[model samples]
Target: MSEAVDWGLALATGVRTASSGPEMSMTEAAAEVAALREAAAAVVEPVAGITALSAPEAPPAVVVDRAEWIRSNAGALRTVLTPLTDGERQVGGFAQPVSSRLAGLQLGLALGWLSGKVLGQYEALPAESDGPQRLLLVAPNIVQAATVMGVDEHDFRLWVCMHEETHRVQFGAHPWLSEYFAGEVAALVRGLDVGPAELAARLASGIRNADSGGVAGWLQSPQMRSRMSGLMALMSLLEGHADWVMDQSEEVVPSAARLRVAFEQRRRGGGLFDAVLRRLLGLDAKLAQYREGAAFTRAVIDQVGLSGFNKVWSGPATLPLAGEINDSTAWVARVRSM
Candidate 1:
């Protein structure tokens, strides 16, 4: 296949039947999704204290299957990875073709696996020509997760909606964030100088050194470190804020406590293939995103109150730096000083 081949579609379409079916019919699923969307929207502003752009312009939420989620994100991923595929450093070499093919194959495998794990995602795109950005709930995965956690289906779905809707309000309140995040991703990709040979060598070495945190430790150059620091800080802020908002709904999901416990255990309970994927994708660090970031958000809110904590949304500069993500006091001091 040519470098421009549609690997995302190929991979996504290949295993469409692997994901489990939802408990309800398609029509019933749509109706329930709509109801849940309204339910989640009702709490958005009150819980987040981040107002939507306009009542009508709020991000539209959709219920999608695992394949749809994969396909939607794949479009974004392809756009982001184009620079890598066509990089200046990707000159002709003995292993150039293999390296490129490996990159494609690994990405396909990762997405296919994650298709079963992710319950929701918020795609903060620039307003499309036809509509605003959409928040997606992957129905099958949500059902599966609810089943796995043994939580009430209704309660679990609503809980997931709240978290995903909080993400919508976050971007809707600050439309600039979509551009800012996209810029960060572009800048990080632009900074990569991976030659074909290095790419091949890294992949080949990945399995042999899986114990030392795999690619993470191997790819710890200063530039990569800086990029990851910025990226992680941003993600922690987004994710932590979402969790904080979700917990603030009018009616609490009593099972949320147990759900959290189940999720924490799940993160630590992956098999070897899962572990290898986490290492390769640097998702191991995401474990800290939940724990440390939530701790930071909770501490800031406790000290400053919700209104004062809104200072984080005042500007990107107020967002916690990497070191400060684990040190809420430091972030509080910095924001308050400003």
Candidate 2:
């Protein structure tokens, strides 16, 4: 049998290079970090009398201690999900090759890459920008790296491993979400209307407010708030479902409850650190999404039972829409009325 290759580098390189042509150069592609940083700064600039959302709560324990968590749970996670993988213990989409997982990573990276693409295609980027055209995953969460760490650190490591693995699986299964998020961000970027004068004035105003609380002031804009809310909703939908799935399989995982409670506290606390980070990073605790999605799944299960809910996974079309998330009452009524 072939040796198991590390999935992390393959995943990252694939995602970073997915859109670039065979010979594409870093010089040819614009950077995304600087652009996103500018956008982040722009969104946080201060306007008069604007107060920030009460510093979104302390993010769950995940961000503060994730590096240690993922290393701990790696083996158990790999074992519990073994049924989904090939004989080599490499998991991929249903009936797909392990290498196909790289395709999934591409989807997540695409949304980040679009930031650079949009800035270059449109004249909206700040001058002197230099960023990579890919989404960056902090190393602690990357699979292959976490896998090699010592077993003694299993508790913290496994928690992060499962969380990231869930992310990878979702992206592999739901390619549409990647396309949708990218489209939304690109649309918003193209819709920018800040002229040079307004930009300068706002930057000046932001500088004055910067001393008050760094970049919290700019985020007070109604438009910025609205956009941030929408993205948070989407992130909730994604992360929530994964968290729920993890919960469902808790019995199979010894440390499940510990990790679950830890993560719950993060989102419930309004997410990690800086108020702007909570909002702009688009990371939500996903408790609401998990409740809604799980309820929807349960409604389907109650109506058709587990077999029927499983059918929903046959394809994306069967998945519930945003409205149907908690609307199990409708499903129950329909069943009874029949």
Candidate 3:
């Protein structure tokens, strides 16, 4: 897998003029990463309770510190999950490595972070790029991955490498992937024009009593319901496929299921104080929908089988709209007929 590669020194640099537009500058990416690191540290350091985790074989103090820093942030890390969202903010677990046993417990989160970051970055790729657009930010925990996954650092690195490389491969193979996803997201954002009465009413009601987490919450208005539906539909397919790819490989990794279940529980459990969602995205749109999306994808896989499920990803036009997920049998037949 170590083919021709760039150390990514210039990779994180600001987005120069690409076909899409000006990409985020490296400086901006760094600042963003720094801010997230601080956020991750803030969450983890407090959890440490002043006593460092006493491992039989801890690395040097600095390595441990870096590892702990990433771990602490693992539970609360947040930023763009997908390129569809601006800044593509998502939590940091995908970039950080935890113990392999712990890896399963956190799979949902890692997938959430990974799926969003990887796919979001893919979607954010500017028009006509030669390869995977440079990552504005990458979160990698050299020490954590080794300890958590019971794998060599290089192997763990390969895991992340695969995630990033998949973005490149998917986009390269199907150039329209990013555009289709981003367009749906932009549509949702555009649909989110709060009405004067609703905005005024929301203001009058005071922020504390807001339907902040509901579908009609601050970030997700009724108007944007269609956008939410469409975005979820798209996300379900993308993430479903990514998770399947990661889970299906028997040769490379054997414990993906354990990791996935653990991760799903964490995702379902919601954040401590439920602050992780609000602090990161200015919304809690993901907390509820992720499980639903997972189920939807699993249902598709079960009903259609891998080949049929994989076939769904052949093109953007074939993808199900928000309406099709609830009634997938109809679409399954439609897919089969076509």
Which model scores highest in TM-score? 1
Give RMSD (Å) of candidate 1 vs. truth.
4.9
Residue 4 Cα positional deviation in candidate 1, in Å, after optimal superposition: 6.0
- lDDT for each candidate structure: 0.61, 0.34, 0.37
Q: How accurate is candidate 3 locally (lDDT)?
A: 0.37
Q: Determine which window of 10 residues in candidate 1 has minimal summed lDDT.
A: 269-278
Give candidate 2's whole-model lDDT: 0.34
Scored by lDDT, the top model is: 1
Error of 2 at 286 (Å): 9.2
Name the runs in model 2 displaced over 4 angstroms: 1-153, 191-233, 267-321, 329-338
At residue 219, give the lDDT of candidate 3: 50
Residue pairs clashing, model 1: none
Model 3, 237-273: lDDT tens digits are: 4444444444443334345455555444433222111
Q: Estimate candidate 1's alpha-carbon lDDT, on a 0 to 1 scale.
A: 0.61
Question: Model 3 — which ten-residue stretch has the worst lDDT?
Answer: 1-10
lDDT of 2 by residue, 13-86 (tens): 33454343223245422332233233222222121001111122111122211222222222211221223233
